[model samples]
Target: MSDTRPTPIRPRPRNDARVVTEAAELGTVLGIWAHPDDEAFLSAGLMAAARDAGNRVVCVTATLGEHGTDDPRHWPPERLAAVRGHEVAASLAALGVSEHHILGITDGTCAEQPPDGVVRRLARIVSDVAPDTIVTFGPDGFTGHEDHQTVSRWATAARATAAPRARLLYATTTAEFAGWWEPTRHTFPVFLTDELPLRTPRSALAVELSLDDARLDRKMVALRAQATQITGLIAALGEERAREWWSSETFVAAEYAESRSSWATWQVAA
Candidate 1:
């Protein structure tokens, strides 16, 4: 018998605010990301919303963000890692998330880590936490950052090995947002030209969370908690634009199938 399984079609992006509400019903939720501020930048609203609804929200960061600072006179690389570690914890706390884990991988060097080792560590974390929902960067890394891409791969691998049934989502932006935001270079010093335009097709997006004022307030607090990295962002975007950008969050659902090997191969749900 020739293998014949119908390929799953990608779902069109809809205003699925209900998904966020449903996620709160899930017992455990995990947000995995590359560096200290990633959770704040991408998923703080969702994290805060989920936590407020009484779900156990956990965040896992892959690196200490040692290379994040442009000013060595103030933050040397060795000390920057520890500083960022504390910052991320504070960020999560601001979102009402009390559980967090750091993989201790070197900042700016995630792509250099042994793939299997990285996957294994993440798998262990997933197994221990057993989240019902897992969120991470899409392939674009939201900014084309190598660490973002590497962590995305690792998170997918870990999900397959440790929590195949978990609902997997990739943080993303709509093409409309990309076109409007990319050309204006609204993300300047924080996100450079080469790093951006990481938007996904609207047709592929799965969820959109329209944050309420309270959730937006928490998100702002979380972002401010990462002061070392976001000072430039606040200065550049100004308070109004920054609030506009942070008012909503979006994600694309990812689908995966078990391969001939023990692992799973992931693709956009389209």
Candidate 2:
């Protein structure tokens, strides 16, 4: 097959947000995430918009999120894994994303896996995709999930090792989102953590997309597809609040991520 690599991503003008409805701003996009609903909660709309724009959008999920529950008795690992695998398919379909990779790393075990092996495998995928933009988690891992952290490290190293020219972005909450969700911070945990999350202020955001009515509806549908994971949270937060919670997608560029001294290092080789 002929190489279809896109042009490297250039810096966008400050204070200007790319209309998600437009194509080429993000180029062919590759998303690397930790669990089944990570992509849905973070970048589903972005992925769908890119696909609609005719860009190649590939998704890589690290685990099935088998332990993503409050009741292990009713939701055992094996059973949850099977169900989540199917749910992810439906979820991705709702977003119009057809290319997906499920790296079968066991749930809750990524931090223990040998980094070199994981990075090598991810590097292979990066080399194959040749995406102009790569999106994943930052240092805080969104909700400080160990799996999210490990995946972030692997994805970053892989990008450095195999596709350094690609633009890198980390999914992050904006200050607005932090404020909007502050009231229920303890009542409703969006991801795996109960701690206050790190946010990227609006001024520093590279790409922030507030889904329009149509896109927000699509995102809700995609998120709802993972009923086993999101149903209860939606019920507790109420539909409107739940919708408002994820209606916007925010990401910071690699330079911003690197600027944080605590999250500074990027592995040069797998």
Best by lDDT: 2
Ten residues in sequence with the least summed lDDT for candidate 2? 261-270
**Taking the tens digit of each residue's C-alpha lDDT, what string does model 2 give over 12-42?**
5565554233434899899999899999999
Q: What's the lDDT of the predicted structure labeled candidate 2?
A: 0.80
Which regions of candidate 2 fall more than 4 Å away from where they truly are? 1-24, 190-195, 258-270
Clashing pairs in 2: none
Give Cα-based local distance difference scores for all models.
0.75, 0.80
Model 1 Cα lDDT, one tens digit per residue, 25-78 = 555889899889999988898888788888888889988888776577688878
Model 1 spans > 4 angstroms off: 1-9, 12-27, 186-196, 256-270
Q: Residue 52 CA error for candidate 1 (Å)? A: 0.7
